[model samples]
Target: MPTILCQLEAVLRFLSNDPGDPNMQACRDGLRQAIAALKRHIQAGSSR
Candidate 1:
């Protein structure tokens, strides 16, 4: 969905920043969550 893509873009932007920064961990977590949610959405959509 558009919302998930937007969130993914935001996470990518955060990752594009300093990789050594402490906030990178938070960004990585967010990206993981977003990817998982996106996968769920896709699976649900496909099953319907």
Candidate 2:
């Protein structure tokens, strides 16, 4: 799970300098949401 999160974060960083096109912006937003969701999941698991 951590591996997946790391890879997603790496991709987000790589896209940081991309042109401000609509598609790229959407992709970045989606990645951010996915990373947030994964972090929430991990935290929830740890509290059990």
Candidate 3:
């Protein structure tokens, strides 16, 4: 699986060039999920 930062970077690049594109929203949503998952993973690790 790709890292959250990589996913976010891809999404950012897509949006930067085509902010109004419909696929841009999809990419953004994917990035959001990736970031949320990464955060959860970090929090879980820190609590241990």
Model 2 TM-score on a 0 to 1 scale? 0.87
Weakest lDDT window of 10 consecutive positions for candidate 2: 14-23
What local lDDT score does residue 29 receive in model 1, on the 0 to 100 scale? 75
lDDT of 2 by residue, 1-48 (tens): 689999999999988788677899999999999999999999999999
Candidate 3 residue runs with Cα over 4 Å from true position: 1-18
Screening candidate 2 with a backbone cut-off below 3 angstroms (N, C-alpha, C), the clashing residue pairs are none
Instruction: Return whichever of 2 and 3 wins on lDDT.
Output: 2
Candidate 1 ranges with C-alpha deviation above 4 Å: 1-20
> How much is the lDDT of residue 5 in candidate 1?
76
The pairs that clash in candidate 3 are: none
Cα RMSD for candidate 1? 2.6
lDDT of 1 at 30: 77
Deviation from native of the Cα of residue 27 in model 2, angstroms: 0.4
